[model samples]
Target chain A: MLPRRLTRPRITLGSPVQLLLLAASFALAAYAGVRLLADDWFGVALWFVGLALLHDLVLLPLYTIADRAIVGGLGAVRRREWTPYVRVPAALSGLLLLVWFPLISGRVDRRYRTATGLQADVFLARWLLVTAVLFGGSALLLALRVRRAAQHRPPAAR
Target chain B: MRDPDAPRLPSSPGFWRSPLRGPWLTSVLGLVLLVGITVLFVTGLVSYAAYNPNLSPVNDKTPDKGILGFYLFAWPTSPHWLYRLNQGVHVTLGITMIPVLLAKLWSVVPRLFALPPARSLAHAVERISLVLLVGGALFEFVTGVLNVQLDYVFPGSFYPLHFYGAWVFFAAFVVHALLKMPTVLRNVRHLREEKNDLVSPRPAEPTVSRRGALGFTGGASLLLFATTAGQNFDGPLRRTALLAPHGGVDPGSGPNGFQINKTAVYAGIDAAETGEDVWRLVVTGRTGTVRLSRTQLAELPQHSGALPIACVEGWSTSDQWWRGVRLRDLAALVGHDDDPPDVFVESLQRRGAFRSAALRANQVADPRSLLALHVNGEELSSDHGYPARIIVPAAPGVLNTKWVTRMTFRGL
Candidate 1:
């Protein structure tokens, strides 16, 4: 156990300045709430609540499950070190996909083409290419790391 | 690559937590996120103010009845790249911040599940603010990204929702920072000391080192940056911007080769309505309003300068030579010429979010502020606001007031 000196509680969380800031923050939020309510309160409120729950529940779990599957699948092969190398690229690619979902899905093909004066047909292919580059780059880094580690190993240990 | 005699590892629920879930990682990522959020907020405020929403409602012609937008002063016009740079950084930083925001959120995930959610009033308030911070941040980023893509996934209007959400997020950000500063500073200093104390052993977690976590997060941010920043950065980097929604393509060709936010067709503007003979620009002053024919407008002392059309949607075009009467010159046409007052610019288009806009005093006074009649060397295309449009330096594309029909100077 820690000594009494370290165990004693300190007022680290809040103070006068922090309280004042909290007040100001609350005031700002209240003002925004009024503005939001004045303009489509129900719809905006529903979006906010629904989105928050969706992110925390559905999206978080979905990503978590996906990550675990990758970790588990890689772990079974005793390739734990390679998990992050794959995960980072995958996550980044997924985020890019999320940001450009409409174009990739061809849902907004006509609208996008009309607005941007560019073909939406190339989006899916471009995303695929970017994803491939990310994975390829990661694989290269992993290969280099393995080569360096192998070189550093003693002959007897090898 | 494991020892043959070593026992096989068993999957655990806690194994998913990142090794970078410590205070130091949170602090560093939080600091970066703070800087990003601050930049976004500041630029967003400038953009909002530039709208001069206080002068007039975007959707309504009846001024002084809508929201008190503090539209008291006109946004500046000099240093022509002002809006371009602010909006560029606003958008690029927002995109790069995706990874940082994710990492910061992930770093603090464990805290969300902490037992007994609050112990005191302060803790309760902190938790409340945390909810606002997370919710507001998510709302802002998601809506912002979608809006830039012109995807109206949400049901309500974008401007008001986004504007209000910004305040909520900003408030939460301020409070969260205030509450977390001591802890954040302590952790940051602890990290620095650890780096300096070479004799001390490094953190021993083998799943993923702090360096690895930082590397991956930073790499994701950089990748996001490289892929999306071309919307504003242009140049050779533009080709690599695979994710840029509008890759610097100017819809108009030749003398009119400048990117467009709203085309005549898209804006529901009839082609026949914009004929030179039928078009006339009305300029209201202190004493009276003067109507000028297209030919008369052409006869005025025309000034030419290159100016970029920067949009709030985060796409900007290369500078195109614009020729027309200066706004100050137009203001001079009527009495009370010196230090011109705020002017309400009206567009010929029957309906649109930006059919009309309020131009602040500074915008009214700027010499570069033009009631443009021609682009490059040719007459303005119907799509490029034929007859006349207001093109002010550093003003948002929307406020450039396409197909300008009237300008009523609000009393000084």
Candidate 2:
């Protein structure tokens, strides 16, 4: 029912509604971008684009390699079933670090102490303690599972 | 398009080998974000409104808010714990959802590198929106987390930066969600992951099932919640919030043992100025300006209310007993006998944000709202907003101006 030009472009992809909505989204984003850039263009743009690149190119690759290494290392001991136990604890610990790195590293020591009157020094120790507990607890659980599996095994297989 | 024999690029389908990355997984993560992000956005907006941004150029931190302030209304006062509950949920849930967000990103990351960049105009537009969605999410989360930790290395003030970034991000988010919703529903309903680039052509031996990965993410979120939620409470539980800025033991003991966001030294409060003999509470309104000393304020019809100090940074104190004259009574003293208009409160805080703030008329009229003179059966210490302070039910802590020196009720 539509005209030829409209139908032709429409066949390529998306309906008119989709295009309109996308345009609206772009316009809103542009407005916000203008406001943000007006204050701190360099920092805002860097954080906006650079973080994506950093995560995709650098952080993802590093974490993948680390995970691969962990899996490979466990394979040497034929304890590959234990990978989740290690992975779970490590991921959780890494997440805590990611979210609270400023505190855990004491990067904001004087400012934090002055503003809050509490020692930022405590976070580093607390984070370490948490990591230890996670790993220790996971190890304990793995041990129990291994023992239970061993007991369930057939004599011929053993 | 005809050259299928050429060696594959990184963007080629063959490069990605994660067997776990599939539409089913992506859709699952998307569903979680649908709920989580909606809550985050709503609570974030509510937190902004609680500051009563309508009182522009005074309490409004985000200048030129324009149409974005459409939802702005006088934040309520009935619950008293409203701001505390809202902010606690906002910060705690924001932190807890990180694992889910990361996993969701990981699930769809290969799309970020898809070859030819765009096959059609629609596809190109979709991809651009994806960039905004991802970038905005990261920017908002990073800035928020950093601000919570009191790390202000980022350029610009936290208010406008976060406010603008959120709008941009949510705009893209809405588009992306709508475009992808149908696919998500179909993928989830069918419970089948059709073979695509996300599926490895030659997968290695599987280490864990898809369900296991999801469980791990959920467990990580639960752990974060456990560590972060205690900052919203008081007593022994407060120490459990080791990751939060105000999670440690109180600054001191006894009645003054609760958390304080800014110290007297930090706010640059002069001891000489705030002393009882020198301090004077100035009231300006329809009647005219009336200056009253600290003793004069104590002599007024003293009232008390149990209220909490809830900070936007997401830490809150328990309901400490606050005693002083009602704000409406103060308005009455200034000749507003029937209804109080909006009031602007000024503090002697020489430095930092919220040195002065404005309150909504409803907030002014609230019986619980007071010019708090004492907290928890003792005169407030210098660090605890000595001499006098504003205490309005359900208002953000910063807006409750401290070291009060002037109050202009109505017609500002």
Instruction: Return the top candidate by DockQ.
Output: 2
DockQ, each predicted model: 0.36, 0.65
Predicted complex 2: CAPRI docking category = medium
Question: What is each model's TM-score for chain A?
Answer: 0.76, 0.87
Best by lDDT: 2
TM-score of chain B of 2: 0.96
Worst 10 residues of 2 chain B by lDDT: B1-10
lDDT of 2 by residue, B21-92 (tens): 888888899999999999999999999999888874788878788888999987899799999999999999
Q: Which lDDT value does model 1 have at B62?
A: 24
C-alpha lDDT (0 to 100) for residue A27 of candidate 1: 82
Q: Is the docking of candidate 1 incorrect, acceptable, medium or high quality?
A: acceptable
